[model samples]
Target chain A: MASTLHDTPERNIPVQRISTTTPMSGVTSHPGLAAWSLGYREWLRFVRQRNRVIGAIGQPVIFWVFLSAGLQESFTAAGTSDVQFLEYFFPGTMMLIVLFTAIFTTISVIEDRREGFMQSVLVAPIPRFSLVAGKLAGGASLAMAQAVVFLALGLIWGMPFPALGLLAGMAFLLICAVALTGLGFILAWRMDSVQGFHAVMSVFLIPMWLLSGAFFPASNPWLAWVMAVNPMTYLMAGFRWLLYLGSEERIAAGTPGLAVSLLVSFAFCAVMFWASCRIAQARVRGDVRS
Target chain B: MRPSPAIVISNISFAYSARQALANLSLDVASGEIFALLGPNGSGKSTLFRLLATLIPLQQGEIDILSISVRTHAVEVRKRLGVVFQSPSVDAKLRVWENIRHQGWLYGLSGRELTTRGQELLAQLGLADRAHDSVETLSGGLRRRLELAKGMLHCPSILLMDEPSTGLDPAARYDFWTYLRQLRDEHGVTVLLTTHLLEEADHADRVAILSEGQIVACGAPEELRKEVGQESIVVHPIPDHAKQLAAGIAQRLNVQTRTIEDEIHVTADDATATIASLLEQFGPMVSELRLGKPTLEDVFVARTGHRFWNRPADGDSLDAKGRANRKGVRNG
Candidate 1:
């Protein structure tokens, strides 16, 4: 009934007040720090979960060895005269590694929500865009790290690894990692559970990878049209061009040109990144599904 | 001049799909006060907490925290608010210090300054020795303390907590309250918390009891209790005749009576006199009777005309006197 009763002096005890003002340094005020901190947290979680790290990398390696070995004997394509299935599937497996790492890293978004950490972050002073960027960066880093390990295996497998080619291929992988992880982040952001995310990945990510010129060349007109629209197709083509720089015979004939592939991959990365930022901003307007 | 109130909520309402959680609710909390939003489950206390903490968007009405609008100036409001959610927010994989440090970073505290503050909070929460341990290794009580440490890492001027003592043991709850009081006393931090527990509400300096998205009673706990009555007299008639006995007592004594299951509850200023008169009038019908001081639970019952813990049965009539009591309390 009393509106101002809580303000009475008798009810308020006299204790030394600690000053509430925080020292404002430019570094602390920068939104980048929030992003960096979030990214660091994600990295710590990833490395500490040994099983996750192993599963993310090992599954792709097993898929590469088994799928290529099983298909090498009977696999034949119109453009390739003497190409081995192992060589043909090498770039696909690299993409697979990136995709696996991306999925593993972005899955934490759902876990964070369940654990209540996302709620705390949502209420903080940091911008929502920074949160998105931080998450993407964290996931992209892990994806790229695993992709590099597989790239090393490509080198050992005698897929012509020129120094410039390796550098270009790493750069391409980085771009692809950012793009794929951003896509995964968008999917995971709207998903409430890991099973839901997996279902979405199966419906969306797997088909995109399959349609990319990963296993067989898109020699047929219909399949080539589908592959032309797939972003991962450019990624696979660009990676193949970079990995076998001097050996044009080893590269698939129908794969897009290096410049065209780079341009498309960059465009895809930019669009995915921008779309993710928009989704994060939309969440501020309370468009959250959960 | 006195400082502005820490929080001002006006005409706020929220709904999840078609089910309304809060409706046209308004309240104020002064700076450096321990204010409790008391209610049973589904009373909209948690909804109000989420709105104040800026965890959820304001769908209708306005809320201001520390002079910043929660709708138009959410980031600024967030800067002044430290929230501990009802669910555990600490990352189980991260060490105690890492969690605190990460929270500090989100509030724009970094470098050596953030580290110092993190250590200070850990030490203050009695978690200095466990700073290096992973959060999963800590017990529930310790984890709760760690959550508090993370919330306070940024030195927020106002702390919003939802069911803060939900999973704590009795001793941990005591320690939690002590820390809340210390924050108010030593640092002048205002605290607003939601609790379904009556004892927790009793410990607050002021409480607002919500029922079905409305504030049924709001004032100092003692004042609210006194407003209802100083004492309550409960009588148990034969199970089948409980409703009849309650109606007869209300008509004869001109006192409000509510029947919850087989028990007839009446609020009286003089319990001994009421009991003596009741025994003389209806001794054969009365099976058991007891007199006790009014509690927060009693206040809720008086204002709502139903048990706080149980939903009123379908098709039950609300007593007119109880409606008047609620109207009178709300009007003042």
Candidate 2:
């Protein structure tokens, strides 16, 4: 490798370098700015890595298309009157996109830790809140962006949805994305390898999504109890209610109220975010191996 | 009065699960000086670097930077520190300018001021032309220059680098050290770097030689080398009679001799006279003879009673343990 310090033509140019005494005057630890930079970096990386875009949005769309098409005749969103599988599964597919995006974005946590980028951030003079908030914001925003694309696709597919209802549904989806991203952050924070996160995704994240009544209605008493305890169920209920608000079939089916669903989703998001912050602040055994 | 030391590490110790990495280590580095922690693999230099960088929490004792306690004022210390890690910390996907911009943001720098500072640093490091290029497109030496540019981007008063010359060619290494010297001399920035290479450590103002988690010797490289002797004579006898030749030479010369691995080392007051006597007395027994001014390696051997690179039982395992610890850090 050639010397970068002395070989260039610019080396002959006499320039006075800034000394440490001045220190880029007025620069200090700004948590908000640091957080914004971190979040923006995630967006930059996402745009550059085309495979990540496809994996997060494309794979989930494929699943939704094939699964809904195959089950359109046999499955009829049991217990809901006159609800077609395509529309009934619309909210679920949107949720799946958010979940996939969460997985893709959060997996970078493990990579950053391994590749030494996290070491730089860990040593920076910023509060742990900035780190956690920045990462969750990035993941949540990416997930929401993908979910919105799916939402647009659903509307174009001719599902009956009012403008006001669709706007409210986007709000609900943003909250859902935040909650799911927080979950991913918590799981990926301590994980050392992407494979370990994948293992966790299959055993924990996928099952959580499956049991949230996104793929099928929880008509069986046992299944209903499971979905009732799952936090994702509230997110799905809140989103589905908003997307189908005032529609004859939705009103007849009678999903959970907006207030109750929002309350539970907000509570879940707070807890997950709080837990991730605690992990980030931990001074022992997490930042480095020993 | 002289300013207080820029870094004060007092009686610090760290250990892995069952193996100790650093024990009761203490040293102080003066401001505007280049201090090197010189050691081979598993000598605890890297562990010390990590603790100082705040990448790992201190296990025991205290480390204060510019009078601020690392335990309580880590963030404040971080503000004063610019660290270049052994591993490449810059994102390869990001353009060179993008990496610098983001680094500035992490330190609360932004907008016009950051752009100007970044540009100035890029020009100084001879990377201005490649500012818009992706980092992955650069060679190892250029990437290292970028790392240096990032470390200095915040205009930190102190710079901490771990194995800064690990992957560089000889010319690049020379350029790197020349720039570091300029930082210390022109900007009055204190530098603390860890290196296993003796030549690299020789460039520091002072070097602390660590062995088995302790500082066996600490001083200027020349002073430490002088402590060994005025000159060093390495006698490599035939393999079959290495032990006998060492004993015979010790008796014949009536001087202290150390037998390390297959060679016998004799620190002599006069190399010319000693070599003549050894050749006359044991010409057929000796296979090779080398005489030179004492080096840091000679100092290390004299202090530790072992070869610098070859270790006893504990050292062999230490290499594996150090590797495993690195893997653990990466895997985690």
Candidate 3:
């Protein structure tokens, strides 16, 4: 190899380690302006993290197939739901899709820190807010997209959907996605290890789904009292009210008020977003005491 | 530009909670020169490098990197500087070319300009052939070379590299430095890097000899050696009582003595007769002897009463690397 390299010395650079000098090619062809571009790049990287978003599609698919099929015999046997059980479950599965996407997005924080990308972000000349907003937007937008796909899947599963119902469902799901992603960031910032995040997820996420009004209506006397206070109940109930019940579902559930649910989600996400920003700032300041 | 200092840290003190890491540490790196911060594992070199990089905030003192105040204008200062951390920074999921291009974009590159410059950089780093390959599949040396490539992608004027040669083969270290020197000479990139290897420091433009949390001496590598003002004398004392014998040598010879691991070191004497006479006088108490010049290692030993490798094992300091490798040979 050295002999060939030495024979063609004039054609090729010398066979020696060389620093990038005299404008090496194949970089971003020009100089960069600022650090907002890092946020964009970070968001691009998040989108390519496939496994995290797959559940957003997969979970809703399973719910549409299994839960809807399981309910046919029950609906026939009890005459419980007037509409098809599959259509009744569509709003619930949409909520589940958001839950899966946003929750898994939290784990990205752990991965970034472990992979050293978090350190890279902290060291750049970007504003702290951009880092927080960028990651949140990246995760939330992807979750919203996955949720949209799930909604389209729900449409194909023999579900009746008015145009207004469909648009309202889409808007509600996006808000839920943005809010849940904020919560995930908070959890990820507080927990350093993947195993720890896993523990929190198993203990917190599936149980929250089981108890909240996603699959079953929270009307079993004592359960209704608990569901009234559950923020996720409000979120799911809002989805139900938007997708199937026209404008009367909130009055029936008594607590899944769209206005109240959106307010609560806004406050929850805002607080979590602020917490993520604080944690990042502390890390940049090198106060890793926590 | 005048040949004033490129960096200055004045009265800097820092700690990790209760553990005091840097105690009023100070140093200067001249413009247009390579300054090596040499110390054993726990000598506080990493902390000092972090302060200069503006990766962490300054708590107690003033720091200036390239005439800009690190605290007052850290972001602006960052624009003038670059850093290659000890840990790898490339995204393993991204291909080699995208990784570089993404970093360039973050700094402001875009459009056809990004494409043209990105190609030129990959070729310059000789990573063009592997441009489409995933970063995880590349060899450690190649990944490290990519990092060095990434650091220079933004064309920052000053660069800080933490253990740039760690885990690299000997030949790779040589190649890495060759490009580094080329960058400095051609593009005037002022470079400050940390290395425990004394031989590596021998080739630096200047060296800062750190022991514990403070810099004991700072100058050109040769100048630091000359500061000791005499050839080094290494002695392995008699029996297991090397401690007592070392004390006696320090007392009688009026020179400093540091028992670094198994060896006892003494300097500041042209002492063929002194050793012969001392061997004759002490007879059975002296076991072995060696002689050398006042290199950075010698300067560190002279000021802190221990060699760089032993600087952290002294119990109060937490130099992580020194503590881990104190039992091995100093150079390793």
Candidate 4:
């Protein structure tokens, strides 16, 4: 049991280069490299954990299919004549896919801290911004990738989205992904349990998405005001407007213009990312509760 | 001039919200030495370990690692320190080499150098063959060895480990210590570890016994035990009469006696002589008697005047409440 590596005759041990006089000095930290490493780790974990992929993509596709089928006959937008409920709900379903992936990816923050992996990352020489950036980038990449798959499915179903519209829709999806993942990071950083995060998702995230005109338009005058104030409303509008870029298709009524929606969505992404970095700065202050 | 110590903790104190975790504790660890912090649960050794690892911020006082201040220069201090936590830090989803490779990126190591260093450390820690295996598939001992490889990947001058032997079996523990000693003797890397097991501390070059957020004793294991007494005598008196028997023995032998649970412990200079007189006087009362050379437990009792595992009154567990009350009375 006490057999030594030095005494193992079968193995050729490398010359022990544990330098004593000259300390290992080439170990310099770069923000970009640090960000890439952390982000890459998230992708590696996501690839290994197959259930997360199924959970993120499967639940939303089920929601889109059933909801569209049930509402197809009765539901109609006030201004649009030919648009069916299935077509009307396509953008929201894509948003749902993005939302689910963000939730799945950012929950790893709490798990890492609990399992002691975050302690090592927090103590690393890299800046806190790198930590925040890497996580958000990885999560956003995952969300955008899943959302694109849903978009392709819609195209194959004869939704007839123009090529220019699809390209513009991808840009909007990336913005929404970054913003949502950043929001998830901010929420997950303070939470100690995944159960708490689930509560937040149900009570806060789901309602916020519902009121953003993703599920249905805010037809009531006061409901319109609430949707106008929601950050997700701008994202939903930007996505809807871009999905009909080169075509004469009438999008859902009452959405803000493309310029205003893009401006507000970009602003929302900046704010969420800023808040995430601020909370991550807590690592330096020792406020990051173990 | 003599080189400064590798780690200098000066008058540091910390609190977790309302509870005081560490008091004005101070200690200096010399270069290339194996120092152990020996304490039981709630002894604040974990708090100290966190502070030195730069995981938690300093509340008061200062800690310097190789002349770099931990409070003001944490990133610098982190660069020179290799920290191994009590819980496993490796990602179970990733292969062993993948875990090391990712860790290497955090420290800015890459390509051939990172691969070479990772291979060297894996071979040295006896995990060369397991490099491609997923961490979740490895046994506890093997997982711990992988953790060591990750910590040493950056070629840190000082290794700070918290309870490195907590879940390991005896054979694995011996192998772990063998690796630690080899690190110190051959590479001149300073090793500071925390443990509750007395045998673990016995293997260290120096041991600091902590109790209730304070250092009770600090010295070599042999010196600490010798300071308590030359020999230890444990006398098991008749059931439910330990207090009375302890008082009788203390007065009869003109020595101090402590009754812990059902046993009365007496540290004597001549245990054979004391046992002879004790049997002649109280053979009918004594159920059993055992003699042994003074151990670290004796030294702990001598300095702290209580058992090592005695928790403070506000500790989380309910089982230690009775002992806590007794300890409070002694302190009061």
Question: Which of the numbered candidates is closest to the native, going by highest DockQ?
Answer: 2
TM-score of 2: 0.92
lDDT of 3 at B37: 90
Native contacts retained, all candidates in order: 0.40, 0.43, 0.22, 0.44
As for DockQ, the candidate ahead, 2 or 3, is 2
* Clash count, one per candidate: 0, 0, 26, 0
Give candidate 4 regions above 4 Å deviation.
A1-26, A283-290, B1-3, B311-332
Looking at model 3, what is the TM-score of chain A? 0.77
lDDT of 3 by residue, B1-332 (tens): 43788888899998888888789987777776787998777788888888887777888889988778998987777776767878877888788987887676655566676676667767766678999998989998888878887777767778898888766655666666667777667766678998777666766788887777887887787777777766666676666868887788778877677787667876656656666655766557666665555556667767777656544455423233212212222210
Model 4's DockQ score: 0.36
Candidates' C-alpha lDDT: 0.80, 0.82, 0.68, 0.83
Kindly report the root-mean-square deviation of model 2 from the true structure over all alpha carbons: 6.4
Would you list the clashing residue pairs of candidate 1?
none
Error of 1 at A241 (Å): 1.9
Model 1 lDDT tens row, A1-290: 22121222332212222234443122224478889989999889998899998998898889889998899898764566877788788788888888888888888888888767888888888888789889989988888888888888878877656788778878888899999989998888767789999998899998999888887888789999999999899988998888767766777678888999999999999998888888766543222222
Q: State residue B86's C-alpha deviation in candidate 2, in Å.
A: 0.5
Candidate 1 lDDT at A64 equals: 83
> Between 1 and 2, whose TM-score is larger?
2
Q: What is residue A107's positional error in candidate 3, in angstroms?
A: 1.2
- What DockQ does every candidate get? 0.34, 0.39, 0.26, 0.36
Highest-TM-score candidate: 2
TM-score of chain A of each: 0.86, 0.89, 0.77, 0.90
Interface RMSD of 1: 8.2
How good is the docking of model 1, by CAPRI class? acceptable
Model 1, range B1-332, lDDT digits (tens) per residue?
33568899999999988999999999989998999999877899988888888777899999988778999988888888888888888999999989888887788887788887777667667788899999989998889888888788777889889889867755567667778888888777899999877767878889999999999999899998898787777787855889788988888887888887677888777777877778778777888776666777788888898777774442221222122222120100
